[model samples]
Target: MKAKELMDKEFVYLNCDDNVVEVSKVMEEIRRFTCPVVNDNKQLVGWITSFDITKGLREGNEKIKEIMSSYEEITTIHEDAPARLAVVLTANNKFVTVPVINDDNQVIGMIRSCDIVELLSELYDIKVYKLYEAMQHQLKGVTWEELMSASALVSKKTTGVKISPEDYEANIMNATFGEAIWATGGLEKFFAGLISVGEMVIARKVGKARR
Candidate 1:
């Protein structure tokens, strides 16, 4: 898989002159937290996210350029780069979406975290197991929708194991701040055992259940 295959071509973008209010509106309309900022020549400039808009609104009159993450500092991958590299970059950068640029440094698309996870599933034939592992540690204070999405992914990937509503509720109960740490600890132990036993599928299944 290549960056181009995983990148979302129709991503939301903004102009440098776009104000915080306008940016906020765009975010709302697109239902996305961030937008790539570009110059008149369509060159990547910076990124404006919901966090930037809110911070700017609170501070009042701050320019978009002042709050946006400058494109120069953003981690960008070329279209032909290996998909594995994109996954590694995402893991290191802690960014949900990474910009993909052409040879001219023009922003062409974005590789999202979901895209990487999907590719991992296809490449590894492990269904949503990898997604479960990656997201399990971050489930604290997560929304019900997100939890249900995890469940759906697991159900899709596995055979003979239906993720019932009761299971989802149980997982949500275990994911509360009060219980999440201990549950995650158990998951880690399970992962270690799976590694030692060469039971990758079981590990994925267990991770999905715990997630």
Candidate 2:
């Protein structure tokens, strides 16, 4: 599947002149952590996120250019590219969404992490709600963020090489439980337990579907 097929054309974004306050409101309204930034010509110029807004406020930055990640720093994918690339890009950058650009590098659509996950669930015939329930059960006390952080240690234990703390936090949020376990080489008990539960849930759902 290509990005154009999966990307949402009707999306919210910020212009280079928009301010931190506007960024905050857009994020809240869209319930998104990140947004693409555009120029007056409607070209993809950069990106802004809640993280950027928080830093901008601390620095007293009033303009979008002051707080937004510049085009050079933000990554964009061609609309014709494979949709799975969106998942890789988000995982690598810890981004919630990636802008899809045309040949002229103009913003055309946005591919979100949820989009890829939902597609994956459909392709595999896996029940997403059941998988989420299993994750919630296994991660009762630990925030997904914290469990992600611990995954770095799990990786080290399995591979005998330490993963950067930064990489773990950045990549893990974009990963499903199965992806997380794959990253850790399936050595972590927490992830293994989550997988076991998720498999059982999926099995039950498959049985129900057949019935």
- Alpha-carbon lDDT, every model: 0.68, 0.72
lDDT at 96, model 1: 87
TM-score of model number 1: 0.57
RMSD, one per candidate, in order: 13.9, 14.8
lDDT of 2 by residue, 1-211 (tens): 8989999888886888887876787788878888888877778888888889989988888888888888898888999999878888888887778899999888999888888778866644433334544565665443444444454665576568888757765554455555544554663764574455445445555566699
Instruction: Give the 10-residue window scoring lowest on summed lDDT in candidate 2.
Output: 123-132
TM-score of each: 0.57, 0.57
Residue pairs in candidate 2 whose N, alpha carbon or C atoms collide under 3 angstroms:
none
lDDT of 2 at 62: 88
Best by lDDT: 2
